[model samples]
Target: MTTMPAPRRLLTIAVLLALTGLVATGCVRFPAPESPPPTATAGPPVLPGVQVDVPVEPLPSSEACNATLTLRPPAQMPLPRQMPPNSTMAGILERGRLIVGLDIGSNLFSFRDPITGDIQGFDVDIAHEIAGAIFGDDRRVEFQVLSSAQRIDALRDMTVDVVIKTMSITCDRLRDISFSAPYYVASQRILSFRNSNVTGPAQLADKRVCAARGTTSIGRIQAIQPRATIVSTTTWADCLVLMQQGQIDAATTDDAILAGLAAQDPWLRVVGPSLGEEFYGVGIPKGQDDMIRFVNGVLERIRATGRWQEIRDRWLSILDSGYGAPQPYYRD
Candidate 1:
């Protein structure tokens, strides 16, 4: 080999050593970490351009039940007003109309008259009572059919003066609106095909349950059976129709509502112990203390004069003697 300068030879040896060290150290890059595989228990999985929040535990019916179970109002609860001290009642009278938001699909609470095409039920009677108190005639009231999701928004937007759609009183709802004393007490129940093997909430695991969207029943079902699939419909009647068609394994809702459905279809039956109690109340826009008090007064008078009992008997006798008994709501 030809002789090289000492400095050039040393530089060449240094470059070769550096290259050897890099190779020995394994500096070559490797691949990135792999993402977790999709899981079956994962709820409503994420896909392209979509996101979902995990469903919450089913709400306890007991929360609403305990809130209204007592005859006395909470210490922090506001006292009922005697009457509107000014012209509010007079203004309602001048309008000659008492508009109320109600559920026409809920059988005993509010439903259509097959012959006259008019609304009728215990809730409808309550609306009529309020109208009669404001005007001298109960027939002055006009009914607007509302879905569960539409009830609160309709009241807030003044689309209706009040909501008597078998609405349950709850702290979450109190943040948005005021409620009258509970006019009816109901318990939550599960409905299934007449021969379903599912006995209770414990048995609902992996089952497909149906409920009306925006109703408390959906929350209750999810809470009890986190793994169960839920199918939501716009109305309880629609849920029942789906159940009849064998599209869903079960439906969860108030006992009164299930009772109505069972009455209509012998192929279905309600099962399990009552999930929880619920108290139905009228919803009004918050801060309308005068209107709330006026309603309380009307409710009190009706309870005292046997009119409330008569209305309940006329509509709810199908629920049995236990339901026929008078259970007066708390009124100042």
Candidate 2:
């Protein structure tokens, strides 16, 4: 290779560098320097519109119609395959399956089994009993996943024959749907990090507590602890994630649900006294007197025959929840 003198080599390098700069500015434009990629230093995940300015929804008056008083069951309940002609049970039988609305994420109540992919829980068994009463086979039930807000609408639009989600019986809900006699009575409570020192409502002051929107828990918590800031989540699991991420201080819902959340993470715990009773029922369409009576019959039978106790023991006992089946109440 021929070697150039130092001055000549330096001049050649300068000319090449100048030519490269001119080419970059005049030809390809170098992609306009990339503009830093529209990035942000994110701290935690959150759903949009989750924060809320607590509204004044005073708790529904306790006197708002005996919330648990549902239509009384028939004196002579019909056997499977013997549904009355043109009745709700007959229609369900004709369809060959009972369509149920529930949440798959509601662990211990109706979550999918990790091994088998089947949904089984306390509420699920109650629904199974209804299917057995109508079709002579408990397996003759189809579950449709739904959110808490969609339960009533599902029944109203005939999208589901029943909603076995952990729904509460309240006067406000009673106006929209007829409930089967109270099957499980839950109480609103709080869930927080085990070491968070948030043991009860007293510690909730100024804390951003989360609950699912369109749930009775919101009004109950708001009414009980006006000092705490409340945020709305679309689902209970969202509240759990928010707490896990340290985005929220605590979560409030029925003890049954809080138990499920606590079971998922060892670092979480359920705390506080019951805010109030929340009676869960098999939500039926309003004006479906026969269906309401029939479902109430199923609930009554299960409560008396020890089946309800079996379900309670199987799913909730592991959570240290020894709750008994809620007693039935009849409007008649």
Candidate 3:
């Protein structure tokens, strides 16, 4: 090698040393420039292109029974066509029309006729039968469209005489209102898209489920799948709407109601086993034992004479052809 100046030789040695040091280290490593922690999104989860907020209501207290429990009506109801004097029936008759509180959107239980513009369904038929007994005609009644949350209040405010919506008879509700004998028995069930892999409530983990706000179905859904995101709406119709929009993973309520929704849409189907027992009873104002008795009597007549079966055949035959009226359970 040719001789070099002292300063040049020192610079060359320094550069070689630096290169050797770099080679000693296997590869230049950095502490994975710390990734920014994931940020959470604001507001409740919203469906793409939808403005509605999937409101989450507080889960009912555990003191609320999770079991399938129902109140038993009197053991024996008055015979059909027999109304006690000064009873609720008298007041309703005096009013000229039985002001019945119900939602007109329930597909199977109560829905409006497209051509006739008359409300009709299983629940509507039940109300009509009661009206017929009082006035010999079912049409002598006024149908007040009440949301699910408004049913009890309407009865308490005396705005409506009775609620024939798909009201479930529950222990908590019993404290605030009276109910006739269980006219129809339906279990809490899941209604989901036909293509969904979820077979039942258990599969609802991490899923979004919709139920009518202020109804028993919401509580039951929480009990069955605490991990599920419950979206409580104002009506079962709303639940159906959300499901149709793909905003919810499922709609949960009485199988009867689910059957109604499923009937309207072939893509939707009711799945899952009975999460809890649901007793469909007519909701009456508190301290209205006379009304309870009168309504129970009407229920007995329908169940006895096969009119209940007829209504089921008419409105719910699509779900179960062999369906029969639920036997009344009387506590007294």
Candidate 4:
């Protein structure tokens, strides 16, 4: 009987053995994901107050549009030493005509008068005042129309005496050229069609933006909306033209420049909070202390004599009549 029962028991044991498996392994540890690159810190705080409008227009695709562009280099090559103190008007007078490198394309900072064919703007007036201080006649200025990229180089090569093209006084720029006390303050802003759904920097996620090349405005836009597609041109006017033609969704630049564009096109307006502080100053070749001092004196005189206010009122009144004239910065 014991021998007979073993056959059935053996079959049941064989079936149990076939159902067991040895494939259970211990838990695994995967490598940690790589950390992302460090991002740049935000820039300095923006200064309070708005700037005067800068006139901008659509770029006409004609030879006449190209004819208005010009580039002039700096007049006096920069020396190795820091700027010398031109503390007295007599010192500047010995040097002769005040050579000024300016942007003739920008409306309020530097632009040509359509009727008189004279280069005029707030900066232009400042340049003429410096000339008058040295030569007793504002007409003694040599105005050189220059692009943003060329302005600093022009100063380095001695092609123009000074640069007054709404040049912002930044630490990087201070390394290359000497700057006078800030005469005007501005901030970066965004310009878009009034009816557009975009309201601020956060909404620019998939938008197309335009800005002038070699300007900080582009950096600001990229910082806020890293995914945005950006287009850069040589001038703000060109950027505005592209925007107007529906080539881009937004144009970003100094608020003053944006205001100028808005004035030219009724459909556009400035949006978003100010990006960063911008202090506009005249750029002098490094080591021209004497010239720097002379220019500072002229800037002070213009503010004191109400000429600065006159220029400010003339250009800014239409956009923001409540804003008072800017205070001159004088470094002794």
Candidate 5:
């Protein structure tokens, strides 16, 4: 969605041009040898390469949407490697692997294990469950890392069979893609340094707030505090880096994701009341209803077998006990 109005977009570009001229002319310079190039934004300080999304398709609204609902699971799950003929799972079986899309920078949801050089997290475990269901071997899945902005397009293009990222299901997104039953319910919140005066949403006026580009979080901030400067990054991890460097006042996103960011830095903490709830679900390509039902079947199995709790305890135990696996709901 367009992050800024037309007038503001032009002004920002002009400001950037003017700043480049100043740096080129040696009229002004950063105090340190390695500082981010000057940004034209009046809201938050942005690092080089971190960006502001120009106007695009207006973000879709979640009005009259119950993101928690998804296609019902099959009456009986087929044995692994025994996908129903002509079903989406059967196609995946023919391909010999399940392809998944997710970002590795999302900490507890998904991230690389520096020690093992492999991706692992709550989401990874869930992805494995789906793959294992189809191939009888979780490793039969091919993992593809994606930025937040790329999740839907990746699914639409069939680059991945499904996306197990920290994606929230919404009515607008459903227009282009399908989602599995809600697996996790997250709340939108803010993350700021512990000692910062910007303790909550009320204090966000004119302060620079950072969130991943093209996410619902950015739009919420834009509506909550019109004066707050919203900086868009490619991922929430980028927001964490900018916050650590004092480049931005605060970062906003789902609380579960924020908790991951907080664990990396002692100074960071989730603050203020939650903006709203985010219902996490698997992303499947639009019209892939069989795949949707199959993924829902896997999720249902996980929840019933207590594996859902196991994954949560393994990866998200650090979050306050209030957050837990969401109950599944079906559209049919």
Candidate 6:
């Protein structure tokens, strides 16, 4: 079976460049301060020797909950072939392109295809579907790379019209933003070196486990084993780096992400049953019912037209798990 490969050596070089006053494309790095940076106004202090001027905001996520609880029904709307005048769809049309926020380091979900140098993956296709629905062209999109911590803030601040990243739908997040119907289902899992004795998350007790910042996987790891020291990085690629270097015993996150990481290193393997479920949704600003409805319409078309399965087969079905379209749930 063909496996997806994220260039680990290139990624390591990018990290090194970031530390040495250069940041490669698609990777995020904080600036180094000549002197001790000012005191943090919020969240935790910067890790020793890591100079980050940005404040890390706290975003709460569910621990082990399934996604069925917060599923909201999408509104009925015409196919997005043309803009509905005076509506959110119309506003997006007037702007000439769909603005989407996502992470470029998540291998299978969204990442730069090393050979083509264009960001492409399952999430990228989802964005393309939305763009195609609106402008009759899937290429009419501007992808803004963002870190995991910036997902909600990007939506709330309207920096991105929609967020197609692998974001989970939760009641906690609903308070701040709206979500489309669940498009993909993901479950938390553990990734470790192939020869490691670790069989599952439970075995990682008292060991180090890594997850992306502002993600639910971290909380799930804590619930699985409180003694396990949790490590947070800016991206999943970073987690894979820590695992490669033996800095952490295991990396835990959605199986979708772990598969991509394992593809990069044949020596890595994912162990254990699912920790819990995650239902992915496209995030829209709070109160933007039209935008939510529009996004759902796009998802509905993808599911019904077999496009969803096609995308999965192309990018994700290579993983050990098979693919099936998620049933759309409407709260109304």
- Index of the highest-TM-score prediction: 2
| Candidate 5 residue 226 C-alpha distance from true site, Å | 1.4
TM-score of each: 0.74, 0.85, 0.76, 0.69, 0.83, 0.79
Q: What C-alpha lDDT, on a 0 to 100 scale, does residue 235 get in candidate 2?
A: 76
Assess candidate 6 and give its lDDT: 0.80
Q: Which stretches of candidate 1 lie over 4 Å from their true place?
A: 1-54, 57-87, 321-332
Candidate 1 TM-score versus the reference: 0.74
Tens digits of per-residue lDDT, candidate 6, 54-140, equal 223243354334433333434555555567778887888889999999999899899998898999999999999989888888899
Global CA lDDT computed for model 5: 0.85
Clashing pairs in 1: 58-223
Count backbone overlaps in model 5. Answer: 0
Top-down TM-score ranking: 2, 5, 6, 3, 1, 4
Q: Answer with 2 or 3, whichever has the higher TM-score.
A: 2
lDDT of 4 by residue, 1-332 (tens): 44648889899888766544322332344689999988888643332221112223222111222211112212442221222344434444566667788777676767787899988877887887777665667788788877776888998897888888888766566657777766676777788899998778887887878776556566556766777777766677776677766767888877777777787889998888877756677888888766666566656667678887788777765554233444543322
Query: What does candidate 4 score on TM?
Result: 0.69
**Per-residue lDDT over 18-75 for candidate 5, one digit per residue giving the tens place of the 0 to 100 score:** 9999999999955867878887757555565576532333443444776666788889
TM-score of 2: 0.85
Give the least accurate 10-residue stretch of model 5, judged by summed lDDT: 53-62
lDDT of 5 at 80: 96
Clashing pairs in 2: none
Query: What's the true lDDT of residue 216 in model 4?
Result: 59
Return the lDDT, model 4, position 243. 70
Better of 3 and 4 by TM-score: 3
